[model samples]
Each structure stands twice: as C-alpha cells, then as structure tokens.
Target: MNTEVPRLSVVVPVFNEQDVLPLFVERIRPVLDELGLTYEVVAVDDGSRDATPVVLGLLRRRWPQLRVVRLRRNSGHQSALAAGLRRARGQYLVSIDVDLQDPPEVIGDMLRLAQREGLDVVHGVRADRSSDSVFKRWTASLYYRLIQRMAGAAIPRHAGDFRLLSRTAVDALVALPEHLPVYRLLVPWLGLPSGEITYTRAPRAAGRSKYPVAKMIRLALDSIVGFSAAPLRVATWLGLIGIGICAVLAGAGVTAHLSGTTVPGWTSLLVALLFLGALQLLCLGLLGEYVARIFTSLQGRPAYVVAFDSATDAEPAEDALCRL
Candidate 1:
C-alpha cells in the first residue's frame, strides 16, 4: 500500500452501475494517468445489489490506484459521496458521478485552475444540458432558481456534485455537524474562494439513472429544509392567513344571523372547515419536516456503514472515518 499522500483523489459514489463501471474506468483512468500525478480513485459502492462489486474488484486488480469502499446497505447518493469524501486520501479531492454526464476531460482544467488561481474550490458547471429531457431541464431550472433564491446566488447556476475541493475545503465540510448534508448548498455556504469550469453535460454511458422523480423531490426538500427556515415561516404565514379568513367568515355569519337573513349555512361552513383543515395539515407537515431533521441529528447515527474498504481496512477506525 502506498502510504504517501497523493497529489489528487477522485471520489466516485456509485450505485448499481455495473454496466457503466468499466466504461467510466476506461475514460477516467487515462485522464488521471496523463496528469502524471500520484492519485487515487476512491469508488464508494453504495450497497449495489447487482454485479457492481464484482466489477469493482476486477477493475481494482488491473488498476491498483482504484480503491473500493463497500457500504453495508443502500445508503443514498449523498451519503455514499460523503463516505468517499471522508475516505479519500489525497491533497486535492474531486467528486464526480460514474454516469459520465460530467466529462472527465475537464478535470485537468479544474486542477490547473485551482493551482494557478489559488482557488479552494472549483465547481463543474453544466454550460449546456441539451441531452436532458424537456421536463428534466425545466425542473432542474426551477430547482436551481428556487434554491439560489433561498440560499443566495453564490452557488453556481448549473453545478452539481461534480467539483474539485482543496484539502482545506474538504476538511471544513467534514467538520460540519450535519449528518445528511446537501453538499450543493453546504459547499457554497462555506464561503470558500471558488471558481467554475463549464462543460457540456453528456448522456449517461450506460444503465438507468439512479435518481427518479421521487428521489429528486426528496433532494429538493432536503436542500430547502436543511439550509433555510423559510418553510417554517411560510407555515406561520399560512396559519395567520387561515385565522384571518376564519375571522372574516365568523363576522359575515354573525351579521347574517342578526339581520335574520341566515338560511342554510352548511355549504359555507363545510368549505371553511375543509380550508382550515388543509392549512393545518400543511403547517404540520412543514413543522414535521424540521422536527424530523432534529430527531435524526439527535440520533447521531452515521449516514453509512462501511462493510469493507480495500485500501483502508488496516487503518484505525477513527482515522479511516476522518472524524478526527
């Protein structure tokens, strides 16, 4: 095992990407090799249920620089990425997906920009995403706009998890107490000196996308709730609006009764009840989202459990976790 610190570490969080793993390795390996840097690719397998483990093992044998960290269960993408980031052993760390959407070729440019300009972080922004579906592009646009509005525009427009971070930036991120961090927002919120590298997003090399509509919605909720208290404030406003509406309804009812103009108020009463009920539910749901986060934090559970790590199995548990 090479105990010396490498110049770069690429942290790849992969799920069931058996079909694309080889293709990713073929493309990414050569690019890193050409850089002439002693680097390691930390591939964190997020409890894949397919032949992904087998493929990674085979790839590791051929490419000694490739290290595999297998999680005990299917933790989400961000958790897997966090695991890789914690485990990566390099001076400079780059996080990218195995789907090949973000080109590996631009990595060299990112490193150069970081070195030349003394940037602590380099974001890989999608200059063009023509390959995405119309619905996807529209939703992505809305997601970014909404988040940028709440979290501020310090975050680049089209950047995702594909970015480079200096050791300092990585250490800062790992030091944060958040267990389920939305890195898209958290990284920018760190207020580190950063730059962006634009790349045309490509279609996946192989396999189905791990993120579906449900997961995307979950991610949006996490990003919002984790960063801002705007949801709770919105809930407060809603409750106030509900109270105002009820007050107006009550005054109108009293006037009708006093004037002896009251007939059957059943319809109006039912409508008011339904409206109030919906508002109450909405407020509870928003509050519940926040309460859930607090509960998770209190539990103090690690987001992922490492079943095995090819390179760091011999290292002490504390050192391996990078919690020190």
Candidate 2:
C-alpha cells in the first residue's frame, strides 16, 4: 500500500455503473498517469447490486493506486461523493462521475490551471452540451439561472459537480454542518479562489443514465431549498396573493349585492373554493418540505455508511467516516 499522501485524488462516485467503470478506468488512468504525479483514484462504490464490485476488484488488482470505498447500501450519488471527499488523502481532490460524459482528459487541464493560477477550486464547466436532449438543455439552463439568482452567487453557468478542490477547500467542505449538501451550490458558495475550464460534454459511453427526470427534479429541490429560503418566501408571497385575491372577490361580491346583480350560482363559489384550496395546499406542502428538512437535520442521521474500505483491513464501523 502507498502509505504516503498522494499529490492528487480523483474521487469518482459509482452506482450500478458496471458497464462504464472499465471504460472510465481506461480513459482516466492514462490521463492521470501521464501527469507524472503520485495520485490515488478513490472510487466510492455506492452499493451497486450489479457486478460492479467484482469489476472493481478486478481493476484494483491491476491499478495499485486504485482504492475502493464501498458503502453499506445504495446511498445517493452526493453522499458517495461526500464519503470520497472525507476519505481522500491528497493535496488536491478532484470529484467526477464515472460516466464518460464529463471527459477525463479535462482533468489535466483543470489540474494545470489550478496549479498555475494558485486556485483553490477549478471548475470543469460544460462548454457545450449538444449531446443532451433539448428538454434537458432548456431545463439545465433554467435551473442554473434560477439557482444563481436565488443563491446570489456568481456560480459559473453549466458547472456541475465536476471540479477540483485543494486540500484546504476539501477540508472546508467536510467541516460544514450540512448533512445533505448540495455541492453544486455549496462549493461556489464558499467563494474560494477559483478557475474554470470548458469542455464539450459527450454522450454516455456505456450504461443507462442514473439520473432520471425525477432525480434531477429532486436535486434541483435539494439545491434550492438547501441554499436559499426562496421557496419558503415563495409560499409567503403566495399567501399574500391569495389574500389579495380573496379581498378582490369579496369586493366584487359586495358590489354585485349592492347593485342587485348578485345571482345565486354555485359555479363561482366552487371555483373560488377550489382555487383557495389549491393555493393553501401548495403553501402547506412547501412548508412541510422545509419542516421535513428540519426534522432530518434534527435526526442527525449520517448521509452514508461505509461498509468497506480497501485501504483499511477491518470492516469499517457504521457511520465511522460518514458522520457529517
């Protein structure tokens, strides 16, 4: 085992990525090897039910620098990334997905930029995502715009979780109290000295995409609700709007009564009731989401539980490295 700290750590979160893991290894190993820097690839296995673990074992036999951190269950992608971040023993840590969409070749550029400019964080921005569906492109743009405005940070557009962070930056992120961190926002929110490298996104080299529409929406919600109180404020504004609407309706009804134009009809009453009901329900739902987050924080449950770490001999204790 390489006991010495590595110069760089490449943290890749894996979840049922059996098909793409080999290809990812093929591409990423060469890029890092050519850099001639002592680096470790910390692959966080997020409880893959497939042959991913077996494949990882096979690859690790060939790649001495490859380290595997297997979680007890299928923790989400972000949690797996967090586990990697905490376990990574490198001067600088770079987090990327196992999917080949985000090119591994750009890691060299990011590392060089960070080293050259003394940047604590280097973001690998997607210069072009023409490979994505039109709906995805449009929604991604909208999500970024909305998040940037709400976060009030100059978050680089098209920048996802693909980024490199210096040791200090990684420490700062790990020290955060957030249990479920939306790193896409939290990283930029740190306001660290940063640089950007643009890369054209390629289609997935293998395996079906893990992020479906539902997960994407959940991520947006987590990002928005985690960073800003904008959603709560939205609920408040909606309540005010509902009040104003009720007042206007009341006035109209009073005027009709005074002018003797008031007709006995259930349609208007039913419509008004339905609208108010929907508005109230929406507000309640939003408030419930916030309350649920509070409950989760109070519970203090770890985001992930490490099952095994190849670097360590014994089976890891529950929540040993995942208590954030």
Candidate 3:
C-alpha cells in the first residue's frame, strides 16, 4: 500500500461503465502526467453487474495510480462519490464522472486555476451542451434554475460534479452531517473562494448514459429536499389556495340557496371534491418525502458499504471511516 499522500486525487464514481473505462484512462492519464503532479485516481465502483470490476483490476496492474473501491451493493452515484471522497489521501480532490462528457483535459486547467488564484473550489462549468438530447438539456436547465431558487445559493449554472476542491473544502464536505448530500448545492453553500473555467461538453466516448430520466428526477428530489424547506413552504401555499377555493364555493352555495335558485348538480360537487382531494394528497406527498428522509437519518444507517478497497493493505474494519 502506498502510504505517501499524493498532491491530487481524482475521484471518479462509476457504475457499469465497462466500455468507457479504457477510453477514460487513455484520455485522463496524459493530462495528469503532463501536469507533472503526484496524483491518484480513485475509481469507485457502485456495484457494477458488468465487466467494470475486472477491467479496473487489469488497469490497476498497469496504472499504479489507479485505486479501486467496490461497494458491497448498488449505491447511487452520490453515495459512491462520498465513499471515494472519504478514502481520498490528497491535498487537492476532484470529483468527475467516468462518462468523459466533461473533458478530462480540463482537469489541468482546474488545478492551475485553483493554485494560481488560491481558490478553495474550481468549478468546471459547461459552456456548451449541444451534444445532449433535447429533453436532457431542457430538464437540466430547469433543474439548475429551480435549485438555485429553492436552495438560495448561486450554484454555477452549468457545473456538474466536475470540479476541484482544496484540502480545506474536502475536509469540510466530509464533516457535513447530511446523509444524502447534493454536492452541487452543498459545495456552493460552503461559501469557499471559488472560480470557474468554461468548457464545451463533448458526447460520451461510449456506452449509454447511466443517468436516465428516473435517476435524474431522483437526483433533483434529493437536491431539493436535502438543502431547502421550499417544498414545505410550497405545500403551505397550496393549502391556502385550496382553502380559498373551498371558501368561494361555500359562498356560492349559500348565495344560490338564499336566492332560491339551488340547482342540485352532483357533477359540480364531485369536481370540487376531487380537485380538493387531489390537492390535499399532493401536499401530503411532499411532506411525506421530507419526513421519510428524517426517518432514514434517525435510523443511523450507513449511506454506503464497501465490499473491498484495493488501496488498503488489510480488510476494512467494522468501524472504518468509509462506512458512511
């Protein structure tokens, strides 16, 4: 095991990315090597069912800087990233996806900016995303805008997880008590000295996108619920609106009865009942989401479990720091 801490750590959270692993390495290695910095690439395998683990094992033999951490089960991307961040032994840390859509070459720029400007965080913002599907681009735009409004943070508009963090920023993130953290929001909320570099996002080198519509929606929910109480406030507003409607209906009912023109229509009553019921249910559902997260946090369950860590000499102990 290498006891020496590297100057930089590149943490890549991957799941079933067998086809793109080689290409990712091919592109990223040269950038790191050219920068002439001591670095380690920590690739967290989020319980891949394909050849990802095998490929990583083979790559480790060739690239000594490559360290593989396999989760015991299929943890989500953020969980896998958290595991890597905890295990990283570097002065500077970076989180990027294995898809290669965010250019690997830009890593050098991030490092340089972090050093030259003395910034704690350097964000790799996307200048152009012309390669993405129409739906993806649209939803991503809406997601970023919505999160900024709800979270009350000026998170970079087009920045994903591709960014550099200084040692102080890394330690601060690791110490956060959040069970389900949205790094995009959490990092900006840190109020660290930050800078941004724009890059044109390229198409994936190979394989399909791991983040489908369902996962995207899940991530958005986590971000919204984890950082802000705007959902609860929205629910309050909805309840008020529902009450106003009911009051108006009651006034109409009383006026019609007093005027002696009471047309007994089941259809109007049924529509009003259904609409109010649906609105009530929607508000309850939103509240339920926050309550469920609180319940999970109170249970004290680990966010992720590591099945194996290639960087360690012995098996991870029961109380390992990476347990969460």
What TM-score fits each model?
0.95, 0.96, 0.96
**Model 1 quality (TM-score):** 0.95
lDDT for every model? 0.91, 0.91, 0.92
| Candidate 3 structure quality by residue, lDDT tens digits, 1-324 | 789989999999999999999999999998899989899999999999998887887777789999989998898999999999999999999899999999988888888999999999999999999999899899999999999989889899989999999999999999999899889899999999999999999999999999989999999999998899999999999999989999999999999999999997999899999999999899999999999998999999999999888888463443243333
Candidate 2, 1-324: lDDT as tens digits: 558999999999999998999999999999999999999999999999998887888787789999999998997989999999999999999999999999999888898999999999999899999999999999999999999888798889999999999999999999999888989888988989999999999999999999999999999989988888988899899999989999999999999999999999999999999999999999899889889999999998999999888888553443233332
Poorest stretch of ten by lDDT in candidate 1: 315-324
C-alpha RMSD of candidate 1:
4.6
